[model samples]
Target: MREIFEAELQQLGDGLVDMSRLVESAIGRAGTALLEADHQLAQDVIASDHEIDRLERELDERCVHLLAQQAPVATDLRIVITALRISATLERMGDLARHVAEVARGRYPGQAVAPAARDTFVRMHDAAVHVAGRTTELLQTRDVHLAAEVEKDDDALDALHQETFAAMLAPGWTGTPQETIDVTLLGRYYERFGDHAVSVARRITFLVTGDFDSEHAPSHRAEV
Candidate 1:
């Protein structure tokens, strides 16, 4: 019974890693679709959201089964609960990626971002990708160094988001109202993506320290 329980736990970890990969790919491809104006790529990203959803459901069910059958205690219970929270965070990240893709699709042949703000968006996209990638690594390794790196990556995204808004407010800006709105929404989407990654990093911190007082504790709580 213990052996079977351990196997389920391992499988749950693998599922989370897979889910992280899907989110990373979604953000990267969605950014490409937005920047390059690729309608087909945008459509592909939009359609792939369902897979992320499916994985989240599967992982959640596995956690439930483990809790019901094994009745994990102490650190084991913490692990299972954290897995549920992490899965939910990954799922939300996937949704943000899909939202970015939707912006690209909405613009169709035309690019969602205006030429002037393209560089800013590129920086934001790169930071988002880096954070997501680091988040995946942190989940697998539980390395505090990676967790710190994720926080740094999120800082970069925040800075880039501010710059994005600053550029829009500049007197030299010439983009239409529609383009301005697109830039605003896209900036928010990318920023929110980084925020979700940061949340996962915090969960890992909670896992390591078992400190519920951490800033992320409120969001990471599980009924069990």
Candidate 2:
């Protein structure tokens, strides 16, 4: 029974890695779709979100089964609970990617970001994609150092997010109302994407070191 339980735990970890990979791909493609305004690619990203949601449900069900049957204690219990949280975070990350794709799809045949904001969006995209990729690697390897790198990437994303807002509010800004809205939403999507990625990283850190700081807790909602 102990061996079987251990195997189930391993399976849970594998499930998280799988979810991370899907999220990485989703964000990468979503960024491309946003930058190039590729309708088909955007549609593909939106459609693939269902699979991420499905995986989250399946993982949560398995977690519940383990809790009911195995009655995990101490570290094992923590692992199961953390897995549930990470799965939810990955699902949200996937949703953020889909949101980016949705914006691209909504503005099909025309670029989503205006010319003045395109460069900032491009930087945001690159940082988001990098964070997503690092998140996948962090889950796969459980390297605590990788978690620090993820935090750094999140910082870059935050800076770019601020840059987007500054550009939009500048005196010489000339973007139409629609363009301004699109850019605002797009910046938020990428910024939130980075936040979710950081959440995942911090969770992994807690799992590894058995330490958590409430002050630095993950942000799930947008800051006003």
Candidate 3:
């Protein structure tokens, strides 16, 4: 029974890792498509919803099977439950990425961002990709301390998001009304990606402690 359980757990872990990678890829591509106004890339992202949904269903079924067959107790149960939550988080992240892609397509035939403020949006997208990648790695390692760093990383994303807002309100940027909206919305998608990564980190923390802080915001040590 022990061996069987371990094998199932390993399978679950692998599935989670695979899902995280797919989600990260989708997000990164979507961000790039938006910034570059690559219509085909944007369509690819929109088409990826089916893949994300399939993974979510597979992960959910696997988690359920583990719960029923393995009868996981204590930490094992925690691990399984966290995996379930992670599946949902990754699914949501994929959805946000799709939203970014949709915005890109909608803004076709026009600039996606203001010329002067493009650099800031690009930085925000890059930061979001980095945050998603790190948090996914943290999940695989079950590194609670590292997970905690996510909130601060999200804080950085928030700064970039604010810059988008600031630029939109600036007279120069608002001149391109459509581009201004797309930039603001794209910033929102990136911010939400960071927020979702933070949620995954919190889920990991909960799995370990079986306890949660009221605020549960990322701590100084979490950044590590």
Candidate 4:
């Protein structure tokens, strides 16, 4: 019974890694579609959302099944609960990416961001991609150091989000009202994407070390 339970736990971890990989691809492609106004890519991203949702549901059901059958205790219990939280976080991240793609699709055949604000949007995309990639790494390796790095990427995203807003409000800004709205929404989607990535990294840190503070926690130690 113990052996079977351990196998189930390993399977849970594998599912998380797979889900993170899918989200990483989604955000990367979503950013590309947004930048280029590629209708087909945007459509792809939007359609892929169903798969993310499916994974989330499957993970949730697995967690429930484990609790009912394995009756995990102490650290094992924590891991199961944390997996549920991380799955929800990843699902939200997927939604944010889809939202970005939707913005691109809505403005198909025309760039979503205006010329003057393109640089800021591009920077936002880069930061988002970095955060998403780091999130996948942290999930697979459980490397606490990657969690701190993910937080740093989130900070970069926050700065870029502010800069985007600043540009929209700058003097003599000439973008049409609709264009301004698209840029605003795009900035929000990218910012939220970073936020969700950071949340996942922190949850992984908690899962590994039972310590929520990634910065102060010793990298080499985990209570489990």
Candidate 5:
């Protein structure tokens, strides 16, 4: 019975890793679609949303099964609960990626920001890709230390986001008043990308420490 339970948990971990990979690719493709104005790539990412949703539902069901049958305790319970948390974060990442892709589709034949701002967005995209990649590492290794690296990485993205925001606020940024609003949202999308990565890092910390401190409010309930 214990062997079967461990195997089930291992499969749950595998599903989280796979979901992370899918979201990473989706976000990367969305970024490319945004920077390059590639509607087709954006469309592909948009169309892939159903696949992500399907994965999330399947993972949630597996988590429920693990809890129902295994009745995990201590570290085992932590692992199962962490899988649920990670799945939620991954699903949100997919949503953000799809949102970016939608913006890319709307970019048809024109854009809302300066060409220089677009270049900066390209850099932001790179930073987000790095974060997404590390999410997979965190799950695969279950390393709180590696997850710390992602928190540090979020600082870089925050820096980029601030700079982009400042640039957007500059006098000549908006070609039209309407365009200004769009540019602001574009920056927000990038910022929220970092935010999602930070959330994943926090989940990793929870998995290891069984506490959600270093977050806004620490979690008191123990998975065990």
Candidate 6:
């Protein structure tokens, strides 16, 4: 019975790794779709989000079953509960990627980001993608150091998000109202994407160290 329970725990960890990989792919493709105006790719990213959702539901069900049947205690209990939380966070990250793709799809033939803010959006995209990749690595390796790198990547994304607002407020800004709206929304989508990634990182860090940094709690509200 103990061996079987241990195997179940391993399966839960593997499920998280799988979900993180899907999220990483979603954001990378979504960024490409946004920059290149590839309507087909945007549609693909939107469709793939369902798989992430399905995985989350399935993983959560497994966690619940383990809790009911195995009655995990102490560290084992923490593992199951943390898996549930991490799966939920990954699902939200997947949703943010889909939202980015949705914006791209809404704009269709025209690019979502305006010419002046294109460079900033590009940097945001790169940072977001980097953070997503790091998140996947962190989940797989459980290396707390990778969590710190994820935080740094999110900081870069935050700075780029601010740059978008500064461009819109500049005296020489020439974007139409519609363009301004697109820039604002896209910047927010990318910023929120990074925020969710940070949440995942902090959660993994907590699981590894068995200690939550009061300054960097796993709560998304605290991070945002």
Q: Evaluated with TM-score, which candidate comes out highest?
A: 2
Backbone clash count, each prediction separately: 0, 0, 3, 0, 0, 0
lDDT of 3 by residue, 1-224 (tens): 99998898888778877878878888888888878888899999899877988988998999999899888888888788888988898898899989988988887755577786788878888887888788778768987787757777888888888887887777665446676667767777788888888888787778766776712654433221
Question: Weakest 10 consecutive residues, lDDT, candidate 5?
Answer: 215-224
Q: Return the TM-score for each candidate structure.
A: 0.93, 0.96, 0.88, 0.93, 0.90, 0.95
**Arrange candidates by TM-score, highest first: which order?**
2, 6, 1, 4, 5, 3
| lDDT score of residue 24 within candidate 3 | 83
lDDT of 5 by residue, 73-191 (tens): 98888788878877987898899889888888886556545574776777878888888999889888988887778876677777787777777777776446545565667667767
Highest lDDT among the candidates is held by which one?
2
Q: Weakest 10 consecutive residues, lDDT, candidate 1? A: 215-224
How much lDDT does each candidate structure score?
0.89, 0.91, 0.80, 0.86, 0.79, 0.90
User: Which scores better on lDDT, 2 or 3?
Assistant: 2
Off by over 4 Å in 5: 211-224
**True lDDT of residue 49, candidate 4:** 91
Candidate 5 global TM-score: 0.90
Which segments of candidate 1 are over 4 A away from where they belong?
Answer: 215-224
lDDT of 4: 0.86
For model 2, give the 10-residue run with minimal summed lDDT: 215-224
Model 5 pairs whose backbones collide: none
Candidate 3 stretches with Cα past 4 Å from truth are 209-211, 214-224
Model 2 Cα lDDT, one tens digit per residue, 108-148: 99998999899998898889889999999999898989999
Model 4 misses residue 100 by how many Å? Answer: 0.6
Rank by lDDT, highest first.
Answer: 2, 6, 1, 4, 3, 5
Over 4 Å off in model 2, which ranges? 214-224
